[model samples]
Target chain A: MADFEPTIVAFCCHYCAYGAADLAGSMRLEYPTNIRVIRLPCTGKITPVFLLRAFEKGADGVYVAGCLEGDCHFIQGNLVAKPRVNYTKKLIQEVGLEPERLEMFNMSAAMGPRFAEVAREFTERIKNLGPSPLNKKNRNKTDKAA
Target chain B: MVIGERKPFDEIMRMAEGLKKIMVLGCGGCVTVCLTGGHDEVRVLSSQLRMARDKAGNPIEIIEKTIERQCDPEYVDQVESIVPEVDAVFSMACGAGVQFMAEKYTGKPVYPSLNTTFVGGSKKEGYYVERCQTCGECKLYYTGGICPIARCSKSLLNGPCGGSTKGKCEIDPDVDCAWQLIIDRLKSLGMMDRYEDIMPANDWRTNRDGGPRKMIREDFQR
Candidate 1:
């Protein structure tokens, strides 16, 4: 488990989490390279299919990072995505995977350090769980893309 | 609308043990409206099944296609060209759709992905409740549009049946007493006289007791 470098997918809202990641880079914040960020217009657009497909595609961990509560770019995109995240967690559990493999986090666009912190934290969580049973034959392919 | 809920993934996987290739047929009817077996659901369920099969060292190739309505032969025929390519069919529609698929392709094994729940609709976004029993009888004019047959626990004709309390059914506190609703509705409409008339016994012959029934439109057929 210590040597396992998990392929963690972070689905981020453009107005907040994605901007936070950019800020994190500008700040030169050091986070694990294992985390891959997928920028979305809003977390509310995140569907159960997207989360499930991530697991089916062999993601060790998947998390949706959106705007802080009541601070959404589109009024209540974060709140809209909350129940969907919870619903997808149950779905992944149905497939014999740990529900902890998927998570949702909220942060403002200004929180660069929090973005990097979340990256490291989720990576550590996935590392503890080891590689997903459905891990691709060539796991390192995603390493370069991120 | 016919409400359908997907069966457990394990049960579906168990039935899919020997399948190599399949077509996930989705219905664009009641199941779609109910948010169960639609286009997106076919993909989701197919993806899940593919992953589970892959993990178990048995890979399955899935061809996904959703039709207008699985209950109609016109739509079911749309899959004719591709259906022959797959060994079996994994239907994501209701039991009727699944059975229709089975009947159409007697050679291929057809599997149902959902358990057909009831004839119902939802006032709530995600919660659906039954509203009809299809008893081949119409009595809504007298019951103030509230159906005691489907809503009542006992399906009594002269209900309230000494079990209703606090305007709720004795079976479940959450269930509203159908007869109580009828009484209240009739009273509000100044038509309490409708309830005063003693109801006669229902003819079981008109119900499913008469066996499988059909409607023939002689003009349309000709």
Candidate 2:
């Protein structure tokens, strides 16, 4: 279990969270290397289907990082994303996955340290939760075929 | 539009438990507008089922299709070519759509994935409230455009029984008393005198008591 490295997918809004990630790199901030961020035009573009697809395609954990509340570049994109992320959390739970595996975070472009902090925290959470059950089964199938 | 809700996930899974391959049929009519049995829901449910089955190591192949209107034979006929290819069909439409699919493809098992809840319109986004009972009789004129038969807990024709208090139904305090709404609307319309007119015994035969009602237009028939 010590060697277990969970694969995490983070859907980051272009206006804030994505820029914060880039800034984190420029500032020499160190975050876990487990997460792969997919930049979105807005957090509003992150639908429940995308979240579920991420899990189905073997993401151990997923999160949406959007603009700070009332600071969305498109006015209410982050506001709308809040409820959608919450709903998808419930949906993943219904699919027999832990609701904690999916989450939503808010921050502005200047918060590079906060972005790194979130990445490390979420990666730690996923490591504790271990690999997704779907991923395990898929791996077992491939191993047998091999 | 008619309102429908998805059945519980476990219950739906059980319906297709042993099947290897199945078709998830979605409706594009009232159920689509209500967000229960539409193309989007079909994709969501299909993806969820695939993951669930994959996790269990008993993966099942799913075929997805959404017809224009499941209640119409012309639309259901569109799936005739694909019907025989699958072992069973999990219909996400209302009861009428499920039955129509079953009738069209006899010998093939058709299961309903949604429960036909009611004939109503959205009170707001994602919120639906019943407004009609399809009693085969139109009584909206007598009730100030509200249907007490559907909204009233007891479905009483001469309503606002002892159960009504302060415009709320006794059955559920949150529900507005149908008769109260009727009286209020009539008062605003200056037709309160119409309430004094007695309503005779309802003809139950016109409703479900008539058993499997149907309408046939001789002029429309070829």
Clashing pairs in 1: none
Top DockQ prediction, candidate number: 2
**How much DockQ does model 2 earn?**
0.43
What's the DockQ for every one of the candidates? 0.42, 0.43
Model 1, CA-based lDDT = 0.87
Q: Which digits, one per residue and each the tens of the lDDT, describe model 1 over residues B27-140?
A: 999999998999988978887777677666667778888999998888888888888899889998999899888889888899999999989998887789999887888788
Cα lDDT for residue A45, candidate 1:
95
Regions of candidate 2 where Cα sits further than 4 Å from its true position: A135-146
- TM for every model, in the order presented, reads 0.95, 0.94
Give the TM-score comparing model 2 with the true structure, all chains together: 0.94
